[model samples]
Target: MSDDKDVVIKEYTAPAGGWGSMKGMSKILPKEGISPDVLDALRRQNKPEGVMCVSCAWGKPAKPHIAEFCENGAKATAWELTSHRVTPEFFQKHSVSELAEWPDYDLEQAGRLTHPMKYDAATDKYVAVGWQEAFDAIGAKLKTCDPTKVVLYASGRASLETSFMYSLMARMWGQQNLPDSSNMCHETTSVGMKSAIGSPVATIQLEDYDKCDAIFVFGQNVGTNAPRMLHTLQECRERGVEIVTFNPLRERGWERFASPQSPVQMTVGAPTKISSQYHQVCAGGDISAMLGICKYVIEADDRAQTEGGERILDHHFIAQHTVRFDDFATFCRNARWEEIVDESGLSRNAIEGAARVYMKAERVIAVYGMGITQHRYGIDSLYMILNMLFLRGNIGREGAGPGPVRGHSNVQGQRTVGITEKTELAPVERLKELFEFEPPTEKGWDTVESCREIIAGTAQGFVQLGGNFLRATPEHAAMKEGWAKLPIAVHIATKLNKSHLYPGEESYILPCLGRMEQDMQTGGRQAVSMEDSFSHIYGSVGKATPAAETLLSEPAIIAGIAKALLPDNPNVPWDEWVGDYGLVRTAIENVYPDKFANFNERLFVPGGFWKGNPASHREWQTDSGKAEFNVPRALNASGFAEKEGRFRLVTLRSNDQFNTTIYGYDDRFRGIKGTRMVVMMNRADIAHLGIADGDTVALESDAEDGIERVVEGLRVVEYNIPEGCLGGYYPELNYLIPLEHHALESHVPAGKSVPVRVRI
Candidate 1:
């Protein structure tokens, strides 16, 4: 109830059976047996403690002592702490085929996996076995296949030590397949940033936001996805720093945020003022928007040059520290303004207004998230952002640079510690020099390539460190088929997921310790390092006890596997390193000498440490040791659907959700209550289609191989979104994502751009 004219009051009604009745009931009364304790746990699972809290070990270590968990962190804990248990007895009662029919939530909600289980083809059920026995059996099965047939897939949830050991084992065994979660998320930032600058990380720091005069956030919904960032944005807004947002949907969080931490705002119901100006741009329109900004800057520079005034372009910095400016400038000049306005779904005035703001700001920060990466041209789009930043000598500066807000804690850290398929030349030579073993010089298979190899039956085994690979990847049918084709598949995970259920000829599910669980190694109490989106490296130590004693740390599991594989190597003691994470940190310090100095000492601090990048001071680390500008072409993009009467659909996450997991049914901020079965649309477009507010529609993707997904009887919420754009939650509508539709360089599924025609 703010008196401000910009503040609007909206009323919402809760759906039938309370907020999460349908989802809760679905978990309880599934077509299978349910334990009473499991049911009771599910009923009372919304407590302040449990699995949801355990899973989020990201920024918790750095948080003030009083505040423990965020909303999504609690949801993640609730998800893991569910009372359900899919025991050996339960598995014996049901076949894998039967369990596969159940929804992902129902399958996972069945409960904590108490023992290691292996798929038995004869009984068609997963049978319990001793840990050692399971490991030996897996080892035997792996030995039967060629090392090249095995692919090790890792997730962002894994720690740096675990990832390093996993990579070491894979390399020692001669398998170069390392398909990881980074491929699905921030691979574009990695590839694009490396090409633009020598490093593939954001040069900006969290403290830099305080110094920024203006901020431009593209495609990221900080309110829901990364709530912690909202505090920074709120502080900046309060100080009158100009904030501009570019996204297809005018997300409520970006409009206003009610921080639970603020006593005054919480009591008065005063929400944080979000964007000074919001632009509802079309999907995949980032390139145009960036180019338009550059064009305006160039125009301003020309005016300054002619009038003998202050130059809009940082002429001194650009000349001293950048190359190829003339070529990039020419490309921007040739780009038609009409095309930029039309493609971006922004008016000329809006584009000019944004450009004017960009030109005035001395220190600007452009932050983007998955929405900018999960597209066909994601890498190129990122390059455009770098080009724009380079035009003003923004990169490597105090408050100006490109920031890709990565999801998960260590997605970037995992990549930094040699979890990539394409190993760098320096890392390879360094590994050989350090370990005395010749590392593989050739490029390895990425996620898409690994999946393709699995489908082709060339890859016979898959070993996952963490994550739901099957559910996370595109082409669900092919992903499942690829698993079945494998001779053996091993999943090292904390709990049960759909990916674990995809049985191969031989499959093993090895339960590992969760992030929030105490990890007691030979080092006494071990602390693991994780890198945030802002290139800040920090240590995390779990406060909670282990869910089960049988669970092993990720590093220990990798070391055990490596011990079995490489019985004779002497470069580094795998057992010693596994026992103490500090030993592993020493190795990391040796490998990445430039970034991690005094790695052990620095990690002991509460704030952990920052991986210092001198480039933040405008030191370009590109090929010529200078920031390079990329010139984008105006040729008609090929992947866009040309079908008549079709609009592109962008998949997104709800306030109560994360990737591939639905925490609750209520998207409270979006005015969505009780269910995710709804789509945001432009009111004018919905009326033109003769579709009412509530109607059942089948959305068929324009991609030749894309499947038609039916979101039964969804209520269309008409809002201030761009025309020809639709928004829906992912996984439910993930079926619309085609197997072949992905970004060119990164191969991330084009989850943001799927042309579809809706039919009633």
Candidate 2:
């Protein structure tokens, strides 16, 4: 875009829906109510006007026609149907230099692209190109470079079939460099779950929550991040199940929920109370909290043994299925209570109280999100959760286990279908057996490595299935420069985004069909399968018409590119597979037979199919075939400690926000309406900083790896957050994330921890 920065623009924020108003509105309007703007835009486009149907990858499915759409989905839909248009003429009028001055939202809100375009650096303008020409150009570029030099990046929004075919095509071309969104969010779940159990997925089904005596939630914000989960948490609360929440901030969703499904609850303006006990644990202190709970559970068992002959753990199951009991016990004994209490920011008594709830409950479910996953010692934290669950034999049972609430609709499914950069030998052998092509044995680059490769000039081309990669990634300037250095960049997306603007020497934007849109092919109306957070594979039939006639299905686009690139071969049925997605699923079934059994037949079921994860039932797949207890060392003293008066800044999603997209800036639960500039800090911290509730300040963090980012003019809002922890909305503050701050094992950016000083 523009060489100079400092472009001034007006800011806009949308209004909020009140709890009472929202309750009343949920009745008259469908769960996913159609916005007036959305309806008007559809009518203008000569399409049917109505509420959109939404089924998140999570277990919750909204009603048909009036399905529940999250705030992010609303924003996504609105973004797709924007009144603005960026035709070839618009591109010709403004050079890339001028367009670069515009804010990300302004550039994207300009509207849906009507035709395939290529960036011409000579004129600094994008020129419309025919599909054939674009494909030919891509094929020519691929022919020049080694397959290993090309990195294929998949987003969470990509369908399982598309991801599978994309991965297959890459393998057929002999490249293992398939970096995906998983590297950013739930890689820990994949690595941790697979290490703990043979399969890497949550074992508990949606209905299993009904059988749970108690539910423990950590780090995840059920309302803002995964709103559909609020209903299940509410149901458990109504059924008298104890809900314990361990998070640094008291998220609104964890406090109370108003279910639109229940008529009486909606009419009476009653909210379903959630979280019987809310513990404000320090950020990156989850391991300490979990260890404390385990310590108390062990002490209770010891006391029971002394008094009579009762055991807290499932002794029979542990003895039969596990190894390494004495070693684990020794580690637990060596863990000091003082360290746990200090690190967790909670009293030993509070942890004991929480442990009592865990001990008394026969069936317990612990669910966590990015909060626990986005830390330097995140994997250790995750292992601790598994260890605690295993101690009481809480896995793979009817209602007890560890549930990692994954973001995106089909992120989990993408992994199931083999979108991983690090593919195992078994999958590689299976692929060779099925497709008659030897899959790459080398491990591919992850998100971080991909960037490094691109910057180092080793990576020649980049292709994204979806997602705003530049903004979402750490080290924005470096990432942007690396993208610019690439010879070609191809993006398959539904709407315009910041990533689309960061063009390479020759960039192409291939508009694709959205999940809500119909995909009519030669056979019939095609349906895509998505795996929810719980590992349930279900069919998603698109209802709305395509945003543009030129837009293609993601699979079709990939297949077309592959056809153009690869030499014609009998083994590669590229065209046949594109015509029908079943071929892709069949290949996926061959690769991951343990999980995707009869993938085509099972997807037709109304409620979908569940992938089995044996570890949840105490079937440890570790080296010892038992859950391993990892003793964590104290977190390195934070850099914030060196900065005398600064508080550790933790980025959070607003109730109205999702990821980097701001639907409308209204977080009703936080009493934040029509604004995203607010920062949530503990009252004590605010007082200590000599700042009142409504005072404006600049947030500055220590430069990491010699890179700096300063977010200024943030309005301070006092809330029930832990001391030394400050919360601000993501993406707006994503710049504050230092390039060096990332999880040790997962390589996920530490968005939860940024030492910052607030200046009035």
Candidate 3:
């Protein structure tokens, strides 16, 4: 509507998720060329026998509501089930270079891909090619590839059936470089939780939301990121279950919500208040705030010990279930209030108030997102949180545990199905026995490591199952040229993106059936399974028709490549596996018997099945044979000891977007419109720089590297964020994050808190 295209500065005071969400959902119909039949897709989404919502990894309820999907999930479904097609004719008109010039939103608007295409460098255009011919060409190049030099990147959106085959295919090819989308988002949580408890995923189930006495959310924006979670949060609030939140941005999602699906709430025009305690912690202040809370909890317990009153801490549970509590308590007891207040941008009163709530609650669930996991000390921050949870024995209980808010439907599930590159984490002997292949035991590169290899030109071949590898990782600009110089680059995808344009010597785009589209193979229609963040495995069957006859399921495509590349995977039948996905499940069962027994039978069951977390049952898989408490390197876990003029820059995703895919320019939650090129800053920070709200500014990172990372022409908007912090949309601000700036243990890029300065 605004052809002037200026980012509107008006604050949207309207409640989140009411008529606005319905209007937003309505716009998708025209934009995506969606037919009325998309209703079938929606009706089936998140249902027990239907497709899992591709928008997020939030668990589906056992007894799902009438509308189990959220606004974003609807848009994602419409985008998948769009009638618009990028056929061979469309590719014939636009060259890769020309298409690369288009914006991400425009590229996605081009709609679903309907044919396999190969890049012709002579014309710089992609031309349609037969699936067999494409697979043959790619496999021939892959056969000559160095196992260590090859990069097989999985997007985490692929089904478990595809992921299982993907891992086996990489190992069968003697390739070890298998990096995933998890390496960028929740890898810190995985590393941290796996070290403390025995689980890498959430320790709580969907039903736990109903039973929890209190919920403590850290750094995750529940409304926009996982809007479906808001329904449960609303229910908990109605039940008088307290919810405490710690985040840099006072996101609209947590402030107020009007569930559009509820006719009663809509008619009443009243929104549910979400957070009981909203702490605006500074970016990278998770550890400091948590330490303060721990210190308060410890002192409260000490007072009880002296007064001979009931002890505040779960001492008996601590004594039985955890190790090194004494060390952890002593560490917390020494934390200074002044340091905590300075770093967290909060008061001692606030920290103690939260601690009091924690002490009183018998059952508490601790949930966190990327805001806590994309900092330099991300793992250490989680360690402090885990230590706090252990003090009360939150683990191995019904309504309490640590939950890492994972993006993508199955990012965690990918790792669960043997997609890890770490030698220690890899099932080497088990894979050898099951697949009858000498699986690579040596460690391989992660996202950053793979980028380094690409930049160094050491890695020649790159294959992506379903993500934009270059755009998704940090230092993307630095590796763009290197990625172009590779010998072979292949993408298995449903639509075209900028990643496909970064063609190597030979590049191909293999169109695959989407999660919402029925995947018909030689064995008849197949139902792919996905594991949610709650570690719940459910089968997703696409009820809608396929976009084209040429489109193949991801599992079938993997099998095709396997047939051409590794003709006889002796222990495996490429033909039978694609013909029947159930056999792949059985093979997966064979590999991970204890966890995935009878995967096929349990997959389609109502409410599906939970792959039990070891910590949930108090079965410690650690060396101590019990949960261990981690002592922090220091209470100053952020390491940002208040350098003047440096703002803690947090890279955020717009409500209109998911991962690297830009849905639109507007971020409705934050009142951003007409553009994604805006920065949200506190009023004081804007005044400090002598700039008014909406002033165009330039940002330069202080990563201390010789390279001068900069992004100019950004409009600054005043918001209710912490004073010293600034927020901007990701992929645009991704340039500020350096390759070396990552979580030490997890190696996930430290994107959440990049040190940057703004210039008017």
Candidate 4:
């Protein structure tokens, strides 16, 4: 919120990790005041004996490293295990009006909420309320409203058991309005891959990285996003795998990385080079770049066939396992070279070089992130990548497939366990048969639509499991205004967040246990289950004591509310399920027999059992029963019309933060410090706009969508990004992205790619 432009922006000389990550770890460990015993226990996280890291959804190995946690994971654990607490006295000392002016980091550092509290209108303060009273009030409000007017929102941090129970309870209460965090990020990955290959999740496992001959990473900043994936990339490099990257900026993790676990590298100050070739794709130019590669592959195959040489494409695999190759090839061949070069923002030779690497590899894996999915044509871009992989028979093989790095810890698991607005008919029928309740067949609102409804004053109530929906969502100013229309707002959370501060007419904050706390239920200490990015399900048992004595586990809190709402319903057995999570898994197994059979038994496995993807096993589950090639039209130079000072904005997460949670102000890899409201721009772009390196500026949305979004006081920083493409930290830039500007089919906010005009 400060307009000062004196923020420090230095050059980080070292690569991703040598001593920098170690320094960060050392600084965080002491700040949390973790004892030796607790630190030792946290070190065993993600192992068979320990709980999982409550961070990104990156898959862990069968036998994880001795130090299984990364910098981000350590920060998350430290933040959760902090010794601070937001007691009743703290709430009495600070009013909502006073706390509203505080920053996000300050709000979180105030400590975890220790009790259930209700907002007092006259006093402008939250007063501690008994758990039963809070539940009764919420249930009363829910009972009066039509089911369609209520929205049951969820965060990715919730466990599988809790998500399943909540989904069922929401449906039984007569609604399917489940808007989750996945709807904001990777919904396109699901909708896109389903249309292309009949599968939505990643088709490859962690071990596949070692066996793959080549890897193509598009639009992901692995160093800041999912650092643990770097270990696999290093192993791939040692195996002589060709690594090619497509990004607007040269991410340090993709440039070079030194695993701190290795003594030799740490002592000698040497690191393994990650990407063999880096292609700087323009913001929103991923589809164009992918199409260029596909065109080259098709042309190379044509030349090989005419000369009677070894075919560049797998004709046999294409003929048997895939359909519509002729039409796809024809479209690719007809695409003009000039248009491809212009749209991709790269030379034709560079695109051809990438194609050569793709053709040479016997097996290849294509990994993508939000940069590819958060766009106007995100689905089409994903299909373009799948189309290239199909041309070379890269999928359904030992070490080759499509991989989408999920952003949150259990985002995929939440979706897998029926926490979705558009719940399929099969699952609906199964739930009806098992629970004797008919789930709504009508498609419900997603995150974007739900916000629209709230703004339009149509929604009656809103309840969130964990995420900071107000801060993380696009069009925050409008969202806050919409949130005021809700009659009741409930948050089941561990800590204070920006969303909790924005209360409705009747608001309640019910604090819950963190992932690292022992959930001492009626039976004994209980463990929760989660599915990783690769669909690997395993048990996570916490050994640490609870942060606050009054906090309840997520599942227990959900069951308490459910029991209050359905007081006479005898079919649910809510008490029994909360007492023993195994019963919940049993119910899930009965619901998804084919997907999660023997769900409880699998938890005892050393690592975990795979949920299985049909496409990975060479079985197509599509309407055609084959992987179909989609021929999408080539995109233009820019998705939006260009103005003199307009630039494409790509919202990014800093190295010191996660989704909507700011751990610190610095982005180490980017050499930015003590600031979140800064815009990274190309030197040429800065010069063209007559702006200096640290000039304060305001960014306004370019689209004439009738909504004016202008974020002020963001200092400009010159960086090595592509011209006409600017970068800024997320949640701050989120205000400039319109609610209506989202993916076509999935409706995911295009936060990664937005068009804006900058002014001094």
Candidate 5:
């Protein structure tokens, strides 16, 4: 066991997924004490008729190697199928009050939740209770509140089958507040992309890697977030697809990659160089940088027209398939160069260099992640990306379109199956026609609104399917107060988290089977389905047995509560659907015939089925019936990045963590070890702030709400980040972000480019 100071600030120059990939497995796998058949469990993930990797939303390869999973994927598998268990006896040894004080690492490291446990106020600890007894009490409390007062929240861990059932239950219960993990992450992709092209889903496929001339990735770290993507990237680079990365951090993953699956490369051969070019743009500078590129391309076209030069913009596609082209072009042309350079933290030469790469390629695929989404101007940022792609007619092509890699495996599918706060989705009317229930027509609360309602005592109860809502959201201290005031709360989970400690008056932590475990229901056996980031539907059946005898499947637990709440759910056959997950898929197909027509039929296919994006066919679902162009309002989207000389903050994830789950202390890529309380700053900024490397400090938010929010005891480490920028790991640093500091359109928290000042 080493201390925080044991590993100083050091740069890891190895490519992201080589020998460094094995560090996590070698360190944490033995601690998990998993069964000897763990290799079988690993082999089953992301395969044909196998379990989906809980690590990320990266698509599965149709013809994958023997080891299809990545290092992070393997860590997630080992954590899920660990032999350690937090049985009833374990709970008896620790009180709820005492356990609430534990760090997130310790809470998850407690291992699998084994049985239905309820908090006993008398003893200040949890006691095992019967499933029926717990469900009955929860239903009674829920019945006391109106639909508008109750929240049905879900994380991304559940299957689409379970999500479909959960969505049905929320509607059947007359509760339209259907919020899921998407609200905090990719919701911008939904709102912005649809506004630009009339479709929220990506028009990308795994095979597109072969035909794409160039790949432009913005604001996403592929190596740590989705290591399995390296195989695709390596192959694409090998075939001459130019890879361009725009990020604030000079990540090693994009520099080069040595796949663990390749024998010769892992031992003797040189690794594949992933990125042909890498640009370390300042945080929140994507919009300005994007504007610069669009400005250059449009100007080049103007020059080509006057001087008889090579072609630049695709004028034919713009005329045939889009509207508002002139407005977008005028906005780009009117933009000044000095403002673009200043806001983008890049010089004229670098911005022009990136534009050259874009102009050289005939077909390009542009992908972005949370870096562009979790901000005040998240939607605007995404719209700019579309505006750039639209100039070249990237949509409706063989090797080109927009790709948004989601953090959760099936978050997009959850929204597709009707888990949303929006009242007017494509399938919303279909649900009413089939179920004969009038779902609330008014828009419901998102994550931000729900927290506001819960905290203000306007909301009465909360039913979470599978997420760490408290830790995942901003304003952690206030959320704790809201969790205490709820009269009824129910969490269907596979393990313990901090959110579980603050139990409601009648709260129950219901244990459920994980994705790695077989789900044996009354109908015999079940296989669940999840949608990848690219709209590909996959069937994930568990290989290992359940951790405990009392644990039930997610569908079963959701059905039980649905029955208790609506004793006579006449329109829905809860028993039938829960018994057989295939029936849930049938219902999904019934509600969404166009998207998932063959439901179960195409689920088990070798690579699964892709629900086609209509935007890919040059068809629009918007009012204009054509791909639309949207212009950014300003270069500095956040409006606070240049205010008061505050440092721009960007939240980061380590190689050992996924979402909020911390696997180990070491982040092999960024050179972090034995600590999560770190704030990586530029050496010049450290000098300016009168601080040195390894100095302890606190960060205070510059939000206008007049609230004092800070995270103390963060170690400062000098890195290659932009001078006025800072980077820190989140859930630990999540406290400093004010809840109100989120996207105005999509409401995703502005976790990426928050204005903060270091407190000495």
Candidate 6:
């Protein structure tokens, strides 16, 4: 392993996707042992016998190309279907303490878990155990604990059927304490968008991008995170659609991109320019930047009317489909230009230019990601974007709407399947009537609250369907200590992660099948469903053989535990549901009669069915019976006032990684290699600090919390980042962000912005 201090940074001169992506894939695919059969499986994505790409939540095109997967999607598939195994002999050779010394990448490279294991503290080793024994142990511990003290965590990778069964297990156990990955990623989209547009999901379809006259992307890196979306952007660019972007990094995706799938472009080395205009907004300044754009639009509308030009504001749409327009307009107009310029880190001209592009287009689509949501005022930022769209009647119309692109495959679907901490009354009543179990109706803890509850000793055990909970969450030290002191922790996973290594007093690691693997039950092969970002419910069937024969399907594992926990009660048919997933779909349809009436039948179609959203068709389900504009109150400060030498650090993902999974030790697009622990700082900031580009530095958060939050020995790299703002890889710098420093209403961790002091 190369030293992080000896990192390499090059001038990334190539276009986003063209040859670079293809070359990287060529290197990794063969290394991961992805054969021609896997390529055939990937080509059949979104088909009847194919699984959804286990990557970002970018919706698949209505009529997808023959090769439907993107570079990142292919990497994700290869990462999961790697021809490697962690058998009982491997575990026997390495103790838990020995494995703990290995890096996360090495741990992942150790390969898939082939058997259920129990952590033996005496030997500090994990020993293989029978699936029945693992389930029995978990059930025994669950039976002893108060249901409220049990925290049920779900990851985005879990299928809808699996999530449904897990939700039932939590509810049947007399609790609603189900905190999931969505709480950490896109909860702001749910809470804020529901308040504004009456729906928590994206209103636009995947085909809408083709029809959209203008597209605005904020905070998200489309090239790295959702690479497939770049193909749509390239097409939009060809059609002369205006693309505006606001992000701290002037990402290569926003500049130009050459699609590898395009033979002509790949051959000539010519690329389609994506963003028509790009602005580097400072960290934590998304709200201010959005306000600036809205203000410009409001001013331009007034000017057009005064000068006897064409009407800019949509009066008809405003009167019929929206409310409180006057109040929203007043706030935008009253916003100070100086404050907007200072906070946004963009000049007045740039903001106005973006506004002009927006005003010129009749149809507009606005998309955002965690960078906009993972902030103290994230909900407010979402409202600001909606307010801008409402001003021009962009939403609830053809080719125009808000698109809060969620992270993780089927994350939105997991939420739709009732994997929530707070249980609604109607769902509780339906569960009681259908399954013959009285579900607890009281609200439960979210991700942050669950962590706090565990630390406070209110929670005694934890059970997760997937995800690296300890590394993904904030306050790593606290979570580690809390887990170490817990009475029980159970993980249903495919690979070895940090969560499994650091166990409680009694920990059980249950190995499960991956998405690419076939799940055979008593009946036959089972197909599961997933909902994409656009609310499209579709069936996904795994084609690859199981990585290990001993691995059980996620639904089967959950059913096993359920059977053990509720053996005496004969009301629920766990065995039947696991045998055939159709039974699970039937139950789901019964729970959501209107949304999913003929769920199984719809799977036969090409694109599947659209779970109709009222807001998508201009029907408002809000309290006002219309879309409401919000007037965010003025804030005295955007965040904690750091000292003169301190910087606002924003943690982000690299090109080589997805969430916490590291595919390689390089951020190829950003010209970074062989190191993940590096901070990106402005050249001028580096000069002012009297530090060189390769100098190693330490970062300590400016927090009053008694817990010490510091990350040491991170090399610094000079880049085009905003002054007084720094960028680093996530799950690493997540240390500097305290658990309490999260979005106000949504409680999503403020990973995008943290007050930190950089030291030599």
Better of 3 and 6 by lDDT: 3
Across residues 497-601, which tens digit of lDDT does each residue of candidate 1 receive? Answer: 788777888898888776655679876877677776766666666545566777788888787667666656888798798789999999999989887889888
Q: Summarize candidate 3's per-residue lDDT along 348-448 as a digit string, tens digits.
A: 99988999899989999999999888888898889877888888888789899888778899898899888899877777899888777798878888998
Model 2: per-residue Cα lDDT over 322-439, one tens digit each: 5666676677767888888888889998888899999999998989988877776677777777778878778878988888898877888787777877867237887787768778
lDDT of 4 by residue, 200-310 (tens): 889999888878999999889999889999988999998899999999997999999999899988998579999999999998787778888999888888898899988
Clashing pairs in 6: none
Each model's TM-score?
0.90, 0.90, 0.98, 0.98, 0.98, 0.98
Indicate the worst ten consecutive residues by lDDT in candidate 5.
1-10
Question: Candidate 5 regions off by >4 Å?
Answer: 1-8
**Location of the lowest summed lDDT over 10 successive residues in candidate 4:** 633-642
Ranking by lDDT: 4, 3, 5, 6, 1, 2
Scored by CA lDDT, what does every candidate get? Answer: 0.73, 0.72, 0.86, 0.87, 0.86, 0.85
What's the lDDT of the predicted structure labeled candidate 2? 0.72
Instruction: Report how far residue 145 has shifted in candidate 4, in Å.
Output: 1.2
lDDT of 5 by residue, 144-194 (tens): 889788889989878898988888888777667988898988888888888
- What does the lDDT read for residue 154 in candidate 2? 87
The window of 10 residues in a row where model 1 has the poorest summed lDDT is 1-10
Quote the positional error of residue 623 for candidate 6 in Å.
1.9
TM-score, cand. 5: 0.98
